[model samples]
Target: MTLIRLAIIALCMVFTAGPYAEESANLTDGGISVSDKNFPWQLVVDRGKILGCVYDNKFYSLGAILILESLPRKCELASDRNGIWEQLTEAELLLWQESIEEQQATKQEANYIGNDPINDEEARLIRYLRSAKKRADTQ
Candidate 1:
Protein backbone atom coordinates (compact mmCIF):
# COMPACT_ATOMS: atom_id res chain seq x y z
CA MET A 1 0.00 0.00 0.00
CA THR A 2 2.81 2.47 0.86
CA LEU A 3 4.59 1.69 -2.42
CA ILE A 4 1.38 2.32 -4.35
CA ARG A 5 0.87 5.68 -2.51
CA LEU A 6 4.44 6.75 -3.26
CA ALA A 7 3.97 5.99 -6.95
CA ILE A 8 0.71 8.02 -6.99
CA ILE A 9 2.41 10.99 -5.30
CA ALA A 10 5.30 10.90 -7.78
CA LEU A 11 2.88 10.86 -10.71
CA CYS A 12 0.97 13.81 -9.27
CA MET A 13 4.21 15.75 -8.73
CA VAL A 14 5.34 15.14 -12.30
CA PHE A 15 2.00 16.34 -13.69
CA THR A 16 2.04 19.53 -11.55
CA ALA A 17 5.67 20.41 -12.35
CA GLY A 18 5.40 19.92 -16.11
CA PRO A 19 3.43 23.07 -16.93
CA TYR A 20 5.49 25.32 -14.66
CA ALA A 21 8.80 24.02 -16.09
CA GLU A 22 7.65 24.68 -19.65
CA GLU A 23 6.37 28.16 -18.73
CA SER A 24 9.66 29.15 -17.08
CA ALA A 25 11.68 27.83 -20.03
CA ASN A 26 9.61 29.98 -22.39
CA LEU A 27 10.16 33.03 -20.20
CA THR A 28 13.94 32.50 -20.14
CA ASP A 29 14.10 32.16 -23.92
CA GLY A 30 14.25 35.96 -24.28
CA GLY A 31 18.04 36.62 -24.50
CA ILE A 32 18.40 39.34 -21.91
CA SER A 33 16.49 39.23 -18.65
CA VAL A 34 13.77 41.90 -18.45
CA SER A 35 15.40 43.70 -15.51
CA ASP A 36 18.82 43.95 -17.23
CA LYS A 37 17.32 45.30 -20.46
CA ASN A 38 15.19 47.87 -18.61
CA PHE A 39 17.30 49.00 -15.64
CA PRO A 40 20.82 47.70 -15.93
CA TRP A 41 22.45 50.79 -14.46
CA GLN A 42 20.12 50.83 -11.51
CA LEU A 43 20.96 47.24 -10.71
CA VAL A 44 24.69 48.02 -10.33
CA VAL A 45 24.22 51.43 -8.67
CA ASP A 46 21.89 49.89 -6.11
CA ARG A 47 24.43 47.31 -5.03
CA GLY A 48 26.74 49.74 -3.18
CA LYS A 49 25.92 53.32 -4.20
CA ILE A 50 23.16 55.09 -2.30
CA LEU A 51 21.11 57.84 -3.97
CA GLY A 52 19.53 60.83 -2.23
CA CYS A 53 16.56 60.82 -4.59
CA VAL A 54 15.82 57.26 -3.60
CA TYR A 55 16.01 58.05 0.09
CA ASP A 56 14.09 61.32 -0.03
CA ASN A 57 11.28 60.79 -2.55
CA LYS A 58 11.64 57.18 -3.69
CA PHE A 59 12.46 58.15 -7.27
CA TYR A 60 12.46 55.19 -9.62
CA SER A 61 15.62 53.96 -11.37
CA LEU A 62 15.32 56.17 -14.48
CA GLY A 63 14.40 59.23 -12.42
CA ALA A 64 17.36 58.72 -10.10
CA ILE A 65 19.77 58.32 -13.01
CA LEU A 66 18.43 61.46 -14.71
CA ILE A 67 18.82 63.51 -11.53
CA LEU A 68 22.27 62.14 -10.73
CA GLU A 69 23.82 62.24 -14.22
CA SER A 70 26.78 64.59 -13.70
CA LEU A 71 29.72 64.19 -11.33
CA PRO A 72 28.68 67.28 -9.40
CA ARG A 73 25.10 66.06 -9.07
CA LYS A 74 26.40 62.72 -7.89
CA CYS A 75 28.72 64.39 -5.40
CA GLU A 76 25.90 66.56 -4.05
CA LEU A 77 22.96 64.14 -4.21
CA ALA A 78 24.37 60.63 -4.40
CA SER A 79 24.38 60.66 -0.66
CA ASP A 80 22.41 62.37 2.10
CA ARG A 81 22.95 65.82 3.59
CA ASN A 82 25.62 64.22 5.80
CA GLY A 83 27.19 62.65 2.67
CA ILE A 84 28.12 59.06 1.81
CA TRP A 85 31.00 59.97 -0.49
CA GLU A 86 33.44 59.85 2.39
CA GLN A 87 32.44 56.27 3.01
CA LEU A 88 33.42 55.05 -0.48
CA THR A 89 37.00 53.88 -0.95
CA GLU A 90 39.14 54.82 -3.96
CA ALA A 91 38.82 51.30 -5.42
CA GLU A 92 35.04 51.27 -5.13
CA LEU A 93 34.81 54.73 -6.67
CA LEU A 94 36.98 53.64 -9.58
CA LEU A 95 34.85 50.53 -10.10
CA TRP A 96 31.65 52.57 -9.97
CA GLN A 97 33.08 55.08 -12.42
CA GLU A 98 34.06 52.32 -14.83
CA SER A 99 30.62 50.73 -14.55
CA ILE A 100 28.90 54.07 -15.29
CA GLU A 101 31.15 54.72 -18.29
CA GLU A 102 30.57 51.20 -19.64
CA GLN A 103 26.82 51.55 -19.27
CA GLN A 104 26.87 54.94 -20.99
CA ALA A 105 28.87 53.52 -23.90
CA THR A 106 26.42 50.63 -24.23
CA LYS A 107 23.45 53.00 -24.14
CA GLN A 108 25.00 55.22 -26.82
CA GLU A 109 25.71 52.22 -29.03
CA ALA A 110 22.27 50.68 -28.74
CA ASN A 111 19.58 51.85 -31.21
CA TYR A 112 17.07 51.79 -28.32
CA ILE A 113 13.60 52.06 -29.92
CA GLY A 114 13.42 50.20 -33.23
CA ASN A 115 15.06 51.57 -36.36
CA ASP A 116 11.92 52.61 -38.16
CA PRO A 117 12.20 55.56 -40.57
CA ILE A 118 13.35 58.59 -38.58
CA ASN A 119 10.56 60.92 -37.50
CA ASP A 120 11.08 64.63 -36.83
CA GLU A 121 12.08 64.15 -33.17
CA GLU A 122 14.33 61.22 -34.06
CA ALA A 123 15.95 63.27 -36.81
CA ARG A 124 16.64 65.97 -34.25
CA LEU A 125 18.09 63.43 -31.81
CA ILE A 126 20.26 61.91 -34.51
CA ARG A 127 21.56 65.34 -35.40
CA TYR A 128 22.42 65.94 -31.73
CA LEU A 129 24.14 62.56 -31.39
CA ARG A 130 26.17 63.11 -34.52
CA SER A 131 27.41 66.44 -33.22
CA ALA A 132 28.10 64.99 -29.77
CA LYS A 133 30.03 62.08 -31.26
CA LYS A 134 31.98 64.46 -33.43
CA ARG A 135 32.88 66.60 -30.40
CA ALA A 136 33.96 63.50 -28.46
CA ASP A 137 36.09 62.37 -31.36
CA THR A 138 37.83 65.73 -31.47
CA GLN A 139 38.43 65.77 -27.70
Candidate 2:
Protein backbone atom coordinates (compact mmCIF):
# COMPACT_ATOMS: atom_id res chain seq x y z
CA MET A 1 0.00 0.00 0.00
CA THR A 2 2.81 2.45 0.85
CA LEU A 3 4.58 1.64 -2.44
CA ILE A 4 1.40 2.29 -4.43
CA ARG A 5 0.93 5.65 -2.65
CA LEU A 6 4.51 6.67 -3.45
CA ALA A 7 4.02 5.74 -7.12
CA ILE A 8 0.89 7.93 -7.35
CA ILE A 9 2.67 10.90 -5.75
CA ALA A 10 5.56 10.55 -8.21
CA LEU A 11 3.17 10.48 -11.15
CA CYS A 12 1.43 13.63 -9.94
CA MET A 13 4.77 15.44 -9.55
CA VAL A 14 5.82 14.49 -13.12
CA PHE A 15 2.57 15.76 -14.61
CA THR A 16 2.79 19.11 -12.77
CA ALA A 17 6.48 19.63 -13.54
CA GLY A 18 6.19 18.79 -17.25
CA PRO A 19 4.50 22.04 -18.36
CA TYR A 20 6.85 24.28 -16.37
CA ALA A 21 9.89 22.62 -17.92
CA GLU A 22 8.45 22.86 -21.44
CA GLU A 23 7.59 26.57 -21.01
CA SER A 24 11.18 27.40 -19.97
CA ALA A 25 12.56 25.42 -22.88
CA ASN A 26 10.33 27.27 -25.34
CA LEU A 27 11.51 30.65 -23.96
CA THR A 28 15.16 29.62 -24.43
CA ASP A 29 14.46 28.60 -28.05
CA GLY A 30 13.63 32.23 -29.04
CA GLY A 31 9.85 31.97 -28.89
CA ILE A 32 9.06 35.69 -28.86
CA SER A 33 6.22 37.07 -26.78
CA VAL A 34 4.00 39.76 -28.28
CA SER A 35 4.37 42.05 -25.26
CA ASP A 36 8.16 41.83 -25.28
CA LYS A 37 9.81 45.20 -26.10
CA ASN A 38 12.45 43.39 -28.14
CA PHE A 39 9.74 42.11 -30.46
CA PRO A 40 9.31 45.54 -32.06
CA TRP A 41 11.81 44.82 -34.84
CA GLN A 42 13.26 41.67 -36.41
CA LEU A 43 15.46 40.80 -39.34
CA VAL A 44 13.59 39.18 -42.19
CA VAL A 45 15.96 36.72 -43.73
CA ASP A 46 15.52 35.62 -47.31
CA ARG A 47 18.35 34.47 -49.60
CA GLY A 48 21.25 36.00 -47.63
CA LYS A 49 21.99 39.76 -47.81
CA ILE A 50 19.82 42.42 -46.20
CA LEU A 51 17.64 44.19 -48.78
CA GLY A 52 14.73 46.06 -47.25
CA CYS A 53 12.83 47.50 -44.28
CA VAL A 54 9.92 46.21 -42.16
CA TYR A 55 8.10 48.52 -39.77
CA ASP A 56 6.75 46.64 -36.75
CA ASN A 57 3.38 48.37 -37.08
CA LYS A 58 2.81 47.28 -40.66
CA PHE A 59 0.77 44.17 -41.35
CA TYR A 60 2.38 43.41 -44.69
CA SER A 61 6.05 43.38 -45.83
CA LEU A 62 5.30 46.01 -48.48
CA GLY A 63 6.96 48.81 -46.52
CA ALA A 64 10.39 47.99 -47.95
CA ILE A 65 9.08 47.64 -51.47
CA LEU A 66 7.37 51.04 -51.25
CA ILE A 67 10.52 52.70 -49.91
CA LEU A 68 12.55 51.29 -52.78
CA GLU A 69 9.98 52.46 -55.29
CA SER A 70 10.06 55.99 -53.90
CA LEU A 71 13.81 56.36 -54.25
CA PRO A 72 15.27 58.49 -57.04
CA ARG A 73 16.20 56.80 -60.29
CA LYS A 74 19.90 57.10 -59.58
CA CYS A 75 19.46 55.63 -56.08
CA GLU A 76 17.40 52.75 -57.49
CA LEU A 77 20.08 52.02 -60.05
CA ALA A 78 22.61 51.40 -57.26
CA SER A 79 20.38 48.89 -55.47
CA ASP A 80 20.75 45.16 -56.11
CA ARG A 81 17.13 44.30 -56.87
CA ASN A 82 17.59 40.54 -57.09
CA GLY A 83 19.44 39.95 -53.81
CA ILE A 84 17.71 42.60 -51.75
CA TRP A 85 15.09 40.60 -49.90
CA GLU A 86 16.33 40.44 -46.32
CA GLN A 87 15.57 43.15 -43.75
CA LEU A 88 17.08 44.21 -40.46
CA THR A 89 14.89 45.68 -37.73
CA GLU A 90 14.52 49.47 -37.55
CA ALA A 91 16.87 49.85 -34.60
CA GLU A 92 19.57 47.73 -36.22
CA LEU A 93 19.15 49.50 -39.55
CA LEU A 94 19.38 52.93 -37.91
CA LEU A 95 22.52 51.95 -36.03
CA TRP A 96 24.21 50.87 -39.28
CA GLN A 97 23.07 54.02 -41.13
CA GLU A 98 24.37 56.26 -38.36
CA SER A 99 27.73 54.51 -38.41
CA ILE A 100 28.03 55.01 -42.16
CA GLU A 101 27.13 58.70 -41.82
CA GLU A 102 29.70 59.12 -39.06
CA GLN A 103 32.38 57.46 -41.18
CA GLN A 104 31.61 59.72 -44.17
CA ALA A 105 31.71 62.82 -41.96
CA THR A 106 35.04 61.77 -40.47
CA LYS A 107 36.48 61.21 -43.95
CA GLN A 108 35.33 64.63 -45.08
CA GLU A 109 36.80 66.33 -41.99
CA ALA A 110 40.16 64.66 -42.54
CA ASN A 111 40.46 66.14 -46.06
CA TYR A 112 40.42 69.82 -44.91
CA ILE A 113 43.47 71.97 -44.17
CA GLY A 114 43.43 75.14 -42.01
CA ASN A 115 44.62 78.31 -43.77
CA ASP A 116 44.85 80.39 -40.60
CA PRO A 117 48.42 79.81 -39.33
CA ILE A 118 48.44 82.14 -36.26
CA ASN A 119 45.87 84.99 -36.26
CA ASP A 120 42.77 84.45 -34.06
CA GLU A 121 40.57 86.37 -36.48
CA GLU A 122 41.71 84.26 -39.44
CA ALA A 123 41.21 81.09 -37.36
CA ARG A 124 37.62 82.09 -36.53
CA LEU A 125 36.92 82.85 -40.21
CA ILE A 126 38.41 79.50 -41.27
CA ARG A 127 36.25 77.66 -38.72
CA TYR A 128 33.15 79.49 -39.97
CA LEU A 129 33.94 78.72 -43.58
CA ARG A 130 34.56 75.04 -42.80
CA SER A 131 31.23 74.78 -40.92
CA ALA A 132 29.35 76.42 -43.80
CA LYS A 133 31.07 74.16 -46.34
CA LYS A 134 30.17 71.07 -44.32
CA ARG A 135 26.49 72.10 -44.15
CA ALA A 136 26.37 72.76 -47.86
CA ASP A 137 28.12 69.50 -48.72
CA THR A 138 25.74 67.44 -46.59
CA GLN A 139 22.66 68.91 -48.22
Candidate 3:
Protein backbone atom coordinates (compact mmCIF):
# COMPACT_ATOMS: atom_id res chain seq x y z
CA MET A 1 0.00 0.00 0.00
CA THR A 2 2.83 2.44 0.84
CA LEU A 3 4.60 1.58 -2.43
CA ILE A 4 1.37 2.18 -4.37
CA ARG A 5 0.87 5.58 -2.70
CA LEU A 6 4.48 6.58 -3.43
CA ALA A 7 4.11 5.53 -7.04
CA ILE A 8 0.93 7.52 -7.37
CA ILE A 9 2.58 10.60 -5.85
CA ALA A 10 5.53 10.29 -8.24
CA LEU A 11 3.23 9.98 -11.22
CA CYS A 12 1.28 13.00 -10.10
CA MET A 13 4.46 15.06 -9.74
CA VAL A 14 5.63 14.08 -13.19
CA PHE A 15 2.30 14.93 -14.74
CA THR A 16 1.89 18.24 -12.90
CA ALA A 17 5.41 19.55 -13.56
CA GLY A 18 4.39 20.34 -17.16
CA PRO A 19 6.74 20.49 -20.19
CA TYR A 20 9.19 23.09 -18.85
CA ALA A 21 10.37 21.08 -15.86
CA GLU A 22 10.16 17.78 -17.68
CA GLU A 23 11.89 19.19 -20.74
CA SER A 24 14.36 21.43 -18.93
CA ALA A 25 16.99 18.77 -18.40
CA ASN A 26 16.86 17.60 -22.00
CA LEU A 27 16.62 21.19 -23.20
CA THR A 28 19.92 22.00 -21.45
CA ASP A 29 21.43 19.36 -23.75
CA GLY A 30 19.42 20.75 -26.69
CA GLY A 31 16.20 19.18 -27.92
CA ILE A 32 13.42 20.00 -30.36
CA SER A 33 9.66 20.03 -30.09
CA VAL A 34 6.73 21.05 -32.24
CA SER A 35 4.24 23.65 -31.24
CA ASP A 36 1.00 22.45 -29.64
CA LYS A 37 -0.99 24.12 -32.42
CA ASN A 38 0.85 21.76 -34.79
CA PHE A 39 2.10 24.56 -36.98
CA PRO A 40 4.46 23.61 -39.76
CA TRP A 41 7.28 25.17 -37.75
CA GLN A 42 9.35 23.17 -35.27
CA LEU A 43 11.44 24.43 -32.38
CA VAL A 44 15.11 23.33 -32.28
CA VAL A 45 17.98 23.86 -29.90
CA ASP A 46 21.47 22.53 -29.09
CA ARG A 47 21.20 21.70 -25.41
CA GLY A 48 23.91 23.65 -23.55
CA LYS A 49 24.81 25.80 -26.55
CA ILE A 50 21.45 27.04 -27.74
CA LEU A 51 18.37 27.72 -25.66
CA GLY A 52 16.18 26.48 -28.54
CA CYS A 53 14.50 28.18 -31.49
CA VAL A 54 11.54 27.92 -33.83
CA TYR A 55 12.16 27.21 -37.46
CA ASP A 56 10.04 26.96 -40.59
CA ASN A 57 8.44 23.56 -40.88
CA LYS A 58 10.06 22.94 -44.24
CA PHE A 59 13.37 24.71 -43.64
CA TYR A 60 14.30 23.69 -40.16
CA SER A 61 18.02 23.36 -40.84
CA LEU A 62 18.28 26.70 -42.63
CA GLY A 63 16.30 28.49 -39.94
CA ALA A 64 18.37 26.95 -37.19
CA ILE A 65 21.63 27.96 -38.88
CA LEU A 66 20.40 31.48 -39.48
CA ILE A 67 19.49 31.78 -35.81
CA LEU A 68 22.81 30.35 -34.65
CA GLU A 69 24.77 32.65 -36.93
CA SER A 70 22.93 35.81 -35.93
CA LEU A 71 22.95 35.18 -32.18
CA PRO A 72 26.65 35.82 -31.56
CA ARG A 73 26.62 38.98 -33.64
CA LYS A 74 23.63 40.33 -31.75
CA CYS A 75 25.23 39.46 -28.42
CA GLU A 76 28.44 41.17 -29.43
CA LEU A 77 26.56 44.31 -30.41
CA ALA A 78 24.55 44.31 -27.18
CA SER A 79 27.63 43.78 -25.04
CA ASP A 80 29.37 46.69 -26.80
CA ARG A 81 26.54 48.91 -25.66
CA ASN A 82 26.87 47.66 -22.05
CA GLY A 83 23.32 46.37 -22.23
CA ILE A 84 21.75 43.18 -20.82
CA TRP A 85 22.97 40.73 -23.42
CA GLU A 86 23.72 37.83 -21.05
CA GLN A 87 20.22 37.75 -19.62
CA LEU A 88 18.67 38.23 -23.06
CA THR A 89 20.46 35.20 -24.51
CA GLU A 90 18.00 33.51 -26.86
CA ALA A 91 17.40 33.05 -30.60
CA GLU A 92 13.97 34.69 -30.28
CA LEU A 93 15.53 38.11 -29.69
CA LEU A 94 16.44 38.45 -33.37
CA LEU A 95 12.89 37.66 -34.41
CA TRP A 96 11.47 39.93 -31.73
CA GLN A 97 13.68 42.88 -32.70
CA GLU A 98 12.79 42.56 -36.35
CA SER A 99 9.11 42.24 -35.50
CA ILE A 100 9.26 45.36 -33.30
CA GLU A 101 10.99 47.42 -36.00
CA GLU A 102 8.55 46.25 -38.66
CA GLN A 103 5.58 47.12 -36.45
CA GLN A 104 6.99 50.56 -35.65
CA ALA A 105 7.55 51.38 -39.33
CA THR A 106 4.06 50.12 -40.18
CA LYS A 107 2.54 52.30 -37.45
CA GLN A 108 4.43 55.36 -38.74
CA GLU A 109 3.27 54.76 -42.29
CA ALA A 110 -0.32 54.24 -41.15
CA ASN A 111 -0.33 57.66 -39.45
CA TYR A 112 0.10 59.51 -42.79
CA ILE A 113 -2.95 59.29 -45.05
CA GLY A 114 -1.52 61.19 -48.09
CA ASN A 115 -0.04 64.52 -49.11
CA ASP A 116 -3.35 65.81 -50.56
CA PRO A 117 -5.90 67.10 -48.05
CA ILE A 118 -9.52 65.95 -48.47
CA ASN A 119 -10.85 69.11 -46.77
CA ASP A 120 -13.48 71.64 -47.95
CA GLU A 121 -10.84 73.90 -49.51
CA GLU A 122 -9.55 71.03 -51.68
CA ALA A 123 -13.13 70.10 -52.62
CA ARG A 124 -13.89 73.74 -53.59
CA LEU A 125 -10.75 73.88 -55.72
CA ILE A 126 -11.72 70.66 -57.51
CA ARG A 127 -15.26 71.96 -58.15
CA TYR A 128 -13.89 75.27 -59.51
CA LEU A 129 -11.56 73.42 -61.89
CA ARG A 130 -14.44 71.25 -63.15
CA SER A 131 -16.69 74.27 -63.72
CA ALA A 132 -13.92 76.14 -65.52
CA LYS A 133 -13.33 73.16 -67.80
CA LYS A 134 -17.07 72.87 -68.58
CA ARG A 135 -17.38 76.61 -69.40
CA ALA A 136 -14.32 76.46 -71.64
CA ASP A 137 -15.69 73.42 -73.45
CA THR A 138 -19.05 75.16 -74.01
CA GLN A 139 -17.36 78.33 -75.29
Candidate 4:
Protein backbone atom coordinates (compact mmCIF):
# COMPACT_ATOMS: atom_id res chain seq x y z
CA MET A 1 0.00 0.00 0.00
CA THR A 2 2.80 2.40 0.83
CA LEU A 3 4.55 1.58 -2.46
CA ILE A 4 1.33 2.24 -4.37
CA ARG A 5 0.88 5.54 -2.56
CA LEU A 6 4.45 6.53 -3.37
CA ALA A 7 3.91 5.68 -7.03
CA ILE A 8 0.81 7.80 -7.17
CA ILE A 9 2.63 10.70 -5.54
CA ALA A 10 5.49 10.41 -8.01
CA LEU A 11 3.07 10.47 -10.95
CA CYS A 12 1.41 13.58 -9.60
CA MET A 13 4.77 15.28 -9.13
CA VAL A 14 5.77 14.41 -12.70
CA PHE A 15 2.57 15.86 -14.07
CA THR A 16 3.12 19.10 -12.17
CA ALA A 17 6.83 19.40 -12.91
CA GLY A 18 7.38 17.74 -16.27
CA PRO A 19 6.44 18.82 -19.84
CA TYR A 20 2.73 18.20 -19.37
CA ALA A 21 2.70 21.03 -16.84
CA GLU A 22 3.77 23.44 -19.58
CA GLU A 23 0.73 22.61 -21.71
CA SER A 24 -2.79 23.90 -21.23
CA ALA A 25 -5.26 21.49 -19.76
CA ASN A 26 -7.22 21.64 -23.01
CA LEU A 27 -4.26 21.83 -25.40
CA THR A 28 -3.78 18.59 -27.30
CA ASP A 29 -2.87 17.34 -30.76
CA GLY A 30 -6.38 17.04 -32.22
CA GLY A 31 -8.28 19.95 -30.69
CA ILE A 32 -8.74 22.19 -27.69
CA SER A 33 -12.01 21.52 -26.00
CA VAL A 34 -13.50 24.48 -24.19
CA SER A 35 -17.10 24.42 -23.09
CA ASP A 36 -18.70 25.91 -20.07
CA LYS A 37 -20.38 23.38 -17.85
CA ASN A 38 -23.65 25.26 -18.21
CA PHE A 39 -23.34 26.45 -21.80
CA PRO A 40 -24.60 24.45 -24.76
CA TRP A 41 -21.89 25.53 -27.21
CA GLN A 42 -18.15 24.84 -27.26
CA LEU A 43 -14.96 26.26 -28.70
CA VAL A 44 -13.68 24.37 -31.73
CA VAL A 45 -9.97 24.04 -32.33
CA ASP A 46 -8.04 22.11 -34.96
CA ARG A 47 -4.56 20.61 -34.93
CA GLY A 48 -3.85 21.73 -31.37
CA LYS A 49 -4.46 25.37 -32.24
CA ILE A 50 -7.42 27.70 -31.89
CA LEU A 51 -7.95 29.16 -35.37
CA GLY A 52 -11.22 30.80 -34.43
CA CYS A 53 -14.40 30.25 -32.49
CA VAL A 54 -17.16 27.79 -33.30
CA TYR A 55 -20.87 28.41 -33.02
CA ASP A 56 -23.95 26.25 -32.66
CA ASN A 57 -22.46 23.15 -34.32
CA LYS A 58 -20.71 25.23 -36.95
CA PHE A 59 -16.94 25.49 -37.09
CA TYR A 60 -15.02 28.48 -38.39
CA SER A 61 -11.44 27.34 -38.94
CA LEU A 62 -10.18 30.65 -40.22
CA GLY A 63 -8.00 32.87 -38.11
CA ALA A 64 -10.37 35.73 -38.62
CA ILE A 65 -11.61 37.43 -35.49
CA LEU A 66 -13.62 39.79 -37.68
CA ILE A 67 -16.20 37.07 -38.20
CA LEU A 68 -16.68 36.88 -34.46
CA GLU A 69 -17.71 40.53 -34.39
CA SER A 70 -19.48 40.79 -37.76
CA LEU A 71 -21.55 37.63 -37.66
CA PRO A 72 -25.09 38.06 -36.40
CA ARG A 73 -25.31 36.05 -33.24
CA LYS A 74 -26.43 36.40 -29.67
CA CYS A 75 -23.40 37.60 -27.82
CA GLU A 76 -22.69 38.67 -24.29
CA LEU A 77 -19.92 40.79 -22.87
CA ALA A 78 -17.62 39.36 -20.29
CA SER A 79 -18.45 40.45 -16.77
CA ASP A 80 -14.94 40.39 -15.35
CA ARG A 81 -11.91 42.43 -16.40
CA ASN A 82 -9.47 39.56 -16.22
CA GLY A 83 -7.40 39.00 -19.33
CA ILE A 84 -8.64 36.23 -21.63
CA TRP A 85 -5.36 34.80 -22.93
CA GLU A 86 -3.78 32.12 -20.84
CA GLN A 87 -0.13 32.52 -19.96
CA LEU A 88 1.73 30.18 -22.32
CA THR A 89 5.40 29.52 -22.81
CA GLU A 90 7.11 31.20 -25.73
CA ALA A 91 7.67 27.81 -27.40
CA GLU A 92 3.99 27.01 -27.20
CA LEU A 93 3.06 30.36 -28.75
CA LEU A 94 5.63 29.81 -31.50
CA LEU A 95 4.09 26.47 -32.33
CA TRP A 96 0.70 28.05 -32.91
CA GLN A 97 2.30 30.96 -34.73
CA GLU A 98 3.93 28.64 -37.23
CA SER A 99 0.67 26.78 -37.71
CA ILE A 100 -1.17 30.03 -38.44
CA GLU A 101 1.55 31.10 -40.85
CA GLU A 102 1.30 27.85 -42.78
CA GLN A 103 -2.47 28.14 -43.00
CA GLN A 104 -2.24 31.74 -44.16
CA ALA A 105 0.39 30.85 -46.76
CA THR A 106 -1.85 28.14 -48.17
CA LYS A 107 -4.75 30.58 -48.39
CA GLN A 108 -2.60 33.20 -50.09
CA GLU A 109 -1.32 30.71 -52.63
CA ALA A 110 -4.88 29.71 -53.48
CA ASN A 111 -6.00 33.37 -53.62
CA TYR A 112 -9.28 32.39 -52.07
CA ILE A 113 -10.91 33.65 -48.92
CA GLY A 114 -13.69 32.13 -46.89
CA ASN A 115 -15.86 35.23 -46.80
CA ASP A 116 -16.90 37.73 -49.40
CA PRO A 117 -14.10 39.68 -51.04
CA ILE A 118 -13.71 43.31 -50.11
CA ASN A 119 -12.63 45.86 -52.73
CA ASP A 120 -9.83 43.87 -54.35
CA GLU A 121 -8.33 43.12 -50.97
CA GLU A 122 -6.76 39.91 -52.26
CA ALA A 123 -4.89 41.75 -55.01
CA ARG A 124 -3.86 44.44 -52.57
CA LEU A 125 -2.57 41.81 -50.20
CA ILE A 126 -0.66 40.11 -52.99
CA ARG A 127 0.97 43.41 -53.95
CA TYR A 128 1.83 44.10 -50.34
CA LEU A 129 3.37 40.70 -49.92
CA ARG A 130 5.45 41.14 -53.08
CA SER A 131 6.67 44.52 -51.87
CA ALA A 132 7.53 43.07 -48.49
CA LYS A 133 9.45 40.26 -50.17
CA LYS A 134 11.35 42.74 -52.32
CA ARG A 135 12.21 44.82 -49.28
CA ALA A 136 13.46 41.72 -47.46
CA ASP A 137 15.54 40.75 -50.47
CA THR A 138 17.05 44.22 -50.69
CA GLN A 139 17.84 44.20 -46.99
For every candidate, C-alpha RMSD to the true structure in Å: 22.8, 26.1, 23.1, 17.8
Our tally of clashes for model 2 stands at: 0
Poorest lDDT segment (10 consecutive residues) of candidate 3: 72-81
Worst 10 residues of 2 by lDDT: 69-78
Leading candidate by TM-score: 1
List TM-scores for all candidates, in order: 0.24, 0.23, 0.20, 0.23
Question: How well is each residue in 1-139 modelled by candidate 2, as lDDT tens digits?
Answer: 9567444433433333332332423211222333456543355334553233223322222122212222211011115432222343454344334444555554345444443234556556767897999999999
Candidate 2 error regions (>4 Å): 1-84, 114-139
On the 0 to 100 scale, the lDDT of residue 118 in model 1 is 49
User: Which segments of model 3 are wrong by more than 4 Å?
Assistant: 1-86, 114-139
> What's the CA RMSD of model 3 in angstroms?
23.1
Model 3 TM-score is 0.20
Local distance difference test scores for all models: 0.39, 0.37, 0.36, 0.39
Question: What residue pairs are clashing in model 3?
Answer: 28-47, 29-47, 30-47
lDDT of 3 by residue, 1-139 (tens): 9567444433432332233232333221222344435533324233323233333322222112222323321122122232122222343444344444555554344443364336556666766886899999999
Candidate 2: residue 76 lDDT (0-100): 16
Task: Decide which is better by lDDT, 2 or 4.
Answer: 4
Provide the global lDDT of candidate 2 against the true structure: 0.37
User: Looking at model 4, how many pairs of residues clash?
Assistant: 0
Task: Candidate 2: give the clashing pairs.
Answer: none
